[model samples]
Target: MPDPIPATATPTLLYRCMTKGVKDAPESFEYGASWVTARRGMLSVHQDRLECGDWTIPYSAISQAVLFKTSQMLIPCYILKVRTATDSYQFGLSGNKFWSTDLPFPVTREKGRLRYSAFSIIARVILIAALIWYFYQAWA
Candidate 1:
């Protein structure tokens, strides 16, 4: 039903970070800002805190991203500034792990035929075990 990736190509996950922002902003952004997720090649922005709506931002759309840091008294503040073709977004987040790294990274490990990741499989098993333990405790 769908085209498969070429055998020569290996999918690599570079970096991921969570910020707060939205697109086509309103009168005030604080109220409209939501959790925005940034991955190696994409950014997922939820419209509201509940994730009622969303927008996907590809790395190509991003023209520039600036990282700023300032210390207040004894504390430090971090900010991520990203400029797209049509808009600018500032997110208050700590750490510059992504901003400091080189992009379009190559895959470090070989992948299995199945698409499921080892972490996802582990998480599922942990969740099931927790559920079972909860039920057993309730019954006992």
Candidate 2:
């Protein structure tokens, strides 16, 4: 276990992420079409607060932190879910540093389940077929 970051220290970690949901969110926080489209942002972890876009959540307000996995475009995606007394926030993380010991709370990890939508499945099939044809033509 790593020591918790001090309040004055620089952010412990930063990740490229998409905000997926925000329950009981602030008025200025926009969550429109987040489920359908990517809302790219940066998630920064600090000793005191979690900053992402228009939201700044203090660790004291966080009731739970969970790390789980989902999929997008047939690719595995890691999700960080942070819950407060009255609010919950979900972020789809990018890059490899998905866990940190500097967090104020212990993050509960869940088993990953691959979920493929019809569109993604069809697209994957088409991509595989195209690759096979390309290889075959190249060999011929």
Candidate 3:
């Protein structure tokens, strides 16, 4: 056999991210079967595998990868979901990294735009009304 690749070699693509959650993985995979806390780490995409800390998933095992946005604290947050045959991993990624083209699997966008909650709409209306009232008070 030939020599193995050195660990110090740089990956094809790398991003600093937080591992949000995992689906279908064993309870011991991370915090548990699912978690609300995010674990900070560096996600690297190699030619044949994806690595994040101790987790190494082969490219062939990835069924799909989806890029989506959701509202968090009234701000849009980008997420990347990587699905394998038996498990799915979710990562919180920056918007610029979401458009990267180095991955073996294609990343598809969510079907629709980020939907605002009723509470969000109500909050916007209240803010606008407050602004109008303040302007009227100043003019008067």
Give per-residue CA lDDT, model 3, range 22-101, as digits (tens): 44433212222133444566666566777777778787888877766654556565666778877877765554433454
Candidate-wise lDDT, in order? 0.42, 0.60, 0.59
Winning candidate number (TM-score): 2
- How far off is model 3, as Cα RMSD? 10.0
Give the top-scoring candidate (lDDT).
2
Which residue ranges in model 3 land beyond 4 Å of their true spot? 1-35, 74-76, 97-102, 111-140
For model 2, the stretches where C-alpha displacement exceeds 4 angstroms are 1-34, 70-75, 98-102, 114-140
Report clash pairs, candidate 3: none
Candidate 1 lDDT (Cα, 0 to 1): 0.42
Which ten-residue region of model 3 has the weakest summed lDDT? 25-34
- Checking candidate 1 for backbone clashes, the offending pairs are none
Residue-level lDDT tens digits of model 1 in 35-62: 2332212232222111112444455666
Give the per-residue lDDT digits (tens) of candidate 2, residues 1-140.
Answer: 23333434545543333445454423222223343554455566755678877777788888887877555566665667788887877776642444533445567876556355555567678999999999999999
Q: Cα deviation in Å at residue 50, candidate 2?
A: 0.7
Q: Which should have the higher TM-score, number 2 or number 3?
A: 2
